[model samples]
Target: MQRKFACFGGSFDPPHFGHLRIIESVLNAKEIDKLFLVPNFLNPFKSHFYFSPKLRLEWLRILCKESLKVWADKIEILDYEVRQNAPIPTYQTLQFIQQTYSLTPKDKMYLLVGADNVESLHKWQNFDWLQNNVEFVIIPRKGFRIPQNFQTLPFCAMDISSTQIRNKLACSDFVELSRLIPQPILELILKEINCKKIDKK
Candidate 1:
């Protein structure tokens, strides 16, 4: 049988419940054989991350582990993009996966993106090529509405943001942390933030 794969790439600065929820919803709705969570070393548009790439990768691994306990399916966290020295564009990342996996005509590949990304798809590298290539699995965000012409997955809209989580951690707001993030990922974030504070002092 031809396997269907969904490529979900992001910073995953701390990998919150929102991220996991979206992954779970996608799996529940689609016939996806595997959902590859690719953490980018540096997103071309973003300047930097709250956590290091190595730390973010570790967080992703922890997320996959915890997710399996709940989700119980193919959730593969890949370092394909992070391993690269330069910031690779979305089209190139998709292309590399297509080639590396030896995807056959029968197989299907879909790029999982936020509704916000759909609005700015034209700004991405080789936008035309990307549009012509793989299908997109759009997840709705709080402020962003799904586009009329695009197909979207059935997702519970999450208002969570990595930036908000980082800010809460910086201020040591564990109450908000309990609500927005998973326990394992929250521990990791606290550990890293505490270590950085100790290093500074």
Candidate 2:
């Protein structure tokens, strides 16, 4: 039997507990053999000029360790998008994975995204190609309504976001930080916070 895998792509600027919850929820709902957490190297549409790619990757590694108890190997961080040096389109990423992994039509491959992203899917580059190749498993985001076409999936009404986590960190709200991210990820963020403080002086 072909193995089923879910592909979740994002900046994961600071992979938080909300991300873990989504992964866990997906695992529970499907017979997925693996979950590919593909973080973008340099998102064309999204502004990642703040955090370095290495730091983002490290934070994600720590979060995965704390929540999943598994290392980076299990979570494929395909940095192809970032390394492309040009605009990294979503359809290209999906196509590369299909070719690299020999993923046939029988093997299930899902593109895990949030409701906000699903709502904006039409604006994405080569969206028509993306729709034909990948199955989108969308999770809910705050203040975004799921479009009528996407109401069929096993959607979770998660209201958390990475932006909220970043805001809490900026305010030195360590207590809220712990609630938002995994213990290991929180430690990584704390270290970055302290480093930034020391640099200012």
Q: All candidates' TM-scores?
A: 0.94, 0.87
Candidate 1, position 177, lDDT: 93
lDDT of each: 0.84, 0.74
Residue 46 lDDT in candidate 1: 88
Tens-place lDDT per residue, model 1, 1-201, is: 788999999999878988888888888899888788899998898887778888889988887787666555677777888888667898888888889888887888889888878778889999898877788878888788787777788987888999898788878899999999888888777877778889999
Alpha-carbon lDDT of model 2: 0.74
Clashes, model 1: 0
Residues 11-112 of candidate 2: C-alpha lDDT, one tens digit per residue: 787787777877767777877777787777766677554566778777776667666764334466566666765557778888888888898888888888
On lDDT, the leading prediction is 1
- The stretch of ten residues in a row with the least summed lDDT in candidate 1 is 66-75
